[model samples]
Target: MKIALIGAGEVALCLATEFCKSEDEVVVLTSTVKPSLKDLKAEIRLTDYSVENLKKNLDDCDAVVSTLSGPNEFYISAHSNILEACRQSRKCKHFIPSEWNINIEDFPDQPMFSAATHEVVRNKLRSQNDIKWTMICHGWFMEYLLPTKKNPLREIGLAWAMNHGTKVFDMYADGLQKVTLTSTADAARAVLAVLRDSINTGADLPPVTHLAGQTLTYRDLFQLIRTRDPAWKSNPVTFVEVLTAIHEGLKANDALVAIHQMRIMGFTNANHNPKGKALEWGTGILQGLRATSVEEFLDQSEAGEDK
Candidate 1:
């Protein structure tokens, strides 16, 4: 089977590598060049978002998984192109949009820009019967919490939950609340499972899917981080504080500030928990690399740095 992976960044690379190990053809579709993948030999085709170019390249592919992400300036436009490409493809039936987030944030009412874009794309896909699409709502990227070898907080630039170098963390509620999270590798495994299941069962992929590597509270996360570094401190904040901010921001039409702040607030807030439409992958589905815990993820990340 041929899988056309859109995006050549780390996450895309992880998905591409995992897909290639299955003995399936993997083609990377990206406009940007990745120096990180220089040593890896694979087929990569660039896209300029031209309808003709994308349709030509995506033709005859079995699946398309888009992992593109960057500045909000061009994200919607770029992803729209990918969705269109997949829609126009002749052979590709399965498409997974870049919905690698928690199921709670998948609602259309969410004021977040990213959430809005996802809802928009999701609605557009719903009106079509030509192609099948599924979303991977795996909570937050667990990598943001894990320390990388090259840089202590290399992905900090992409994440907004924590302020990286700050020694103090103010979480909402009791901080004992758990939220869904999945490693890139784990998510890739789930995606692979979806691919196999979709092909063998001929089942229509759900509109939204969720995966949590290991559910733990904010206190557990902070304690684990402190256990590894021993200098970080965390404290609990009142939900009223966050609610006030959200109310004030929304009233002021400051959706960006309100939405971004809502992320940490919601994660720390237990009120949002237990209501998500999370997908449960039964045992033996993920196979080899099981979903890892916070402790294990840290060990792996630190161990890699030592090597």
Candidate 2:
């Protein structure tokens, strides 16, 4: 199957890297045609933000997947443009928009403008009949959950903020709120499965397929940490004060505050709001699809760092 991937961002790179090892054809459509990207195994074409170019690019492909990321307004126009192109596409049949995180439709009152734009794109997809679409309702990225030199866990924008040091520290929830997260690696695999099924079986993928590593909370994550280091401590915190601080941060135009709020939603409202049963329905749907648990991923990551 030929796949027209639109973007070269993190998610796109992950998908391209995996797809290159397969027999299927993957052509990346990017606005910036760089010299560095010239050596990639996959084909490259200029998207130039034009529908005609995208339609031509879609001519030979069986599926179109967008990993483009930008402001909500960009999505409102860009995604809709791609969908419209696919609507008139001579060959393209499957479409997966850049909806890599939690399903936006679940949280009707989500604060971020991007969520509203995603909902708009989704609604547009629903009214179409020419192409079939599916979204991976992943909770959060496991890479984001990990403490990095770039994104330290102590920054408070993490679903699991326990690796913050030995302060016997605090967090925003009482800790039983089930926070579900998945790896970009896992998500890439799921995307491949859906696309293959759509092309080969000629059947539409589920409207939404939720993916997650584990349904553990901050408290459970802290306990997992305690297993490796006995010095770790846990304490509950009032969400109101934290939310107040977040609101102030938002007013000040801090991007990190939006990240923090998303983490909060994953920890608190994820279970009830984006009510999904990835564990139940997604368990045996795909062959050998192992959804890594939080403990497994963290333990493995720590050991790798130690090595």
TM-score of each: 0.81, 0.83
- For candidate 2, the clash count comes to 0
* Candidate 2 global CA lDDT score: 0.70
Worst 10 residues of 1 by lDDT: 151-160
Give each model's whole-structure lDDT: 0.66, 0.70
- Model 1, residue 306: C-alpha shift (Å): 2.5
In terms of lDDT, the best-performing candidate is: 2
TM-score of structure candidate 1: 0.81
Structural RMSD, model 1:
3.7
- lDDT (Cα, tens digit) per residue for candidate 1, span 1-307: 7778887776777667667676677788888777755654557787886767888888978888887765564666766676677778887778887766555443445435456666667777888877778877666667777434333223543123444566565564667666556677777777878776776677887776667776766767777777777777765666666567667877888745545454553554322223245445455444554677767877887788789
Local accuracy of candidate 2 as per-residue lDDT tens digits, 1-307? 8888898765677667767767888899998876645656899988865678788888889888898877777877888889878877888978998877664446534535366677788889888777898877776676655654633212443434544444353455677765566766677777777688768878767777776666666677567767766776766666775677688888999766765566456345553324354634254445667777766777778788898
